[model samples]
Target: MYKPRINNKFHKHQIMMEDPCLAEFIPETRLFTNNNLIDLLNKYKKVIVKPSRGSLGKGIVVITELGTEEYELLQLNKQKHINGLENVYKYLKKLENFNIPNIVQYYIPLAKVYDRPMDLRYIAQRTEQDWTITGKYARVAKVGYALTNFEHGSSILTVEDALKSSTIKNFNIKELNEKLNMVTLSITTCLSRYFPNHKIWGCDLCVDEKGSIWIIEVNSSPQIKGFLELESLLPMYQSIVGYKTLNKKKGRRSR
Candidate 1:
């Protein structure tokens, strides 16, 4: 009888940051502060503001460059102008009051499907030898929506369907799967070195216009309820519990 384990996103992030394989994919995330926000805006004319530990794509803002002296903020499906540099600071301060950790990210203009932003959720599991990809779902941001999360009204589509509609269609299905698996494997291998006991992860990936994959975010304790129909889903569920049971038995033996 195996019991599953839950992973904490913050703890995993701290561990992943130390991993050589994942270090490059990890962004230079900083705690949200008026000064930091201003610095980010100055460095990149366009940046993304998002909750550090948020799920389902809630509380995301995309600030874009209007001109050398002007900028626009797209927050929660609404766009507004930041009158001046000082306003950027003020807006960040207001967000801080919510008592949530937020970070400024370099915006990656993700490729679109059906005129909506598209991203991939790579579900992975650890086996006796290595981490293996169990499933991959394509998430398409709803029309006019800022976030491409199912909870944000986005629709779920097969990766094949998504790639068909993408502007970059040079990649065949086999190539795409291989590319995704390689990236996910690299990231998990690195993260596991620091937290060897953990078992599951969901890597959020985006493809740019050039057909290159960029890691948007890494999620621990990924939601698997929606993937029950996937061929690997059952094995993943069993492996989770089986690993926990084996770990407990080993602890007892050591004692």
Candidate 2:
């Protein structure tokens, strides 16, 4: 039997947009083209160009407007300055993955913890009837970086710990926590409609400087070692282990 999982980022975005309730969590994403990149940049001033099928934060580019007719491109934690939008487009197009499908999306000004960007991973597993949030944890990027991958010098923390020190100012922690749960649950529920046999989902999400949550992407197979390594996440981590044990009895598997 085939795995009931989707890896194409563009397709996942299309389905997430279908739900009216998810409109706030979905960003403006378009296929990567010089024209599309120009248009997105014109509107958002900052955008991300990433491989549609890539993961682990590899081959992702963050483009920011530096000044009039000037742009900065950041990749793998290093950045360069380009003189004009045309030049920026040309540089990106010369990359090896340029000819293949990629996506250009609005660059979220992520809520920061001590000037380092932070985002979360929420794991939801299907029970007999509905999806349950099994586990979650936040990733804080190393100072002066864009992507938040644990393997790329990021540090993991409980969501509360990271946000408490955020520059977002005084806010209700409980309410903000609920929003994260709701967004991930809604995303998993929406994705299951397309891949019904899929029993688990790992959704990546981030909060903007405005405190609004954005669903980054859904993973069919998320890395588990991050959860296992964190002492503060022991409870949620055990929940995932329990879910795995239960799934084994039912012959459910993942890829």
Candidate 3:
């Protein structure tokens, strides 16, 4: 049997983990299991367990420790407060209906806006010979949501607007953008080396209350309809078309 390369969350995470420097930006992630859930919840007090191959924030659950032997599970946009570690596992299993491949990551207290969570999405695409960042925007999660997925009622905001309203103290927009770009590019470069055929990436990142940046996820197939609505993104669309044209030309020459 021949298997195709799938860009699942765990696979991409492993690829990034190969590099020590890049690994630092990644949160502590592991295969979601009964034991893993108990340990991570106790460690992080607030951990996120999401589908390994799911998108649009579907099937994502947020688990928070209320106290010893007590926890709160957030899923399906609702909160269920439960007691005991074993009960947490049973509740999740019931909600899932069976075992599903998922990843459990230590939740970082991301910078917020007006008490709403938010994250930055870096749109990087490959040109003729190199990777370039074409767009950057912030997704302010809907009130009381754990994920900032655009499909889930999240609003798109300019990076400046997000930073201006950010809860991170002494936030520097200029410095943050610089660091974000550098890390986004680095991730694309590393992933490209492994999956050379893929050229576009949408990297989701966040800044903690302490001003430390963390990579939440790297989306290989990012939705662009929301971005296309902005007239300012015209140049980026052109660049993408240009890259397609250039690649076509090279393909002809090779033949």
**Model 2 over residues 126-177: C-alpha lDDT tens digits?**
8776899988888999977898988888888888888887766567889999
The better candidate by TM-score, 1 or 2, is 2
Q: Candidate 1: list runs displaced more than 4 Å.
A: 1-28, 96-98, 225-255
Model 1 residue 234 lDDT?
59
User: After superposition on all CA atoms, how large is the RMSD of candidate 1?
Assistant: 5.4
Q: Please, what is the TM-score per model?
A: 0.78, 0.92, 0.90
- Please tell me which predicted candidate would have the highest TM-score against the true structure: 2
lDDT of each: 0.70, 0.86, 0.81
Residue-pair clashes per candidate, as listed? Answer: 0, 0, 0
RMSD of each candidate relative to the true structure: 5.4, 3.0, 2.8
Stretches off by above 4 angstroms in model 2 are 1-5, 252-255
Ranking by lDDT: 2, 3, 1
Summarize candidate 3's per-residue lDDT along 100-169 as a digit string, tens digits: 6788899989889878888988888877558888778788888878778889888777777888888988
Roughly what TM-score does model 3 have, to 2 decimal places?
A: 0.90
> Against the true structure, candidate 3 has what lDDT?
0.81
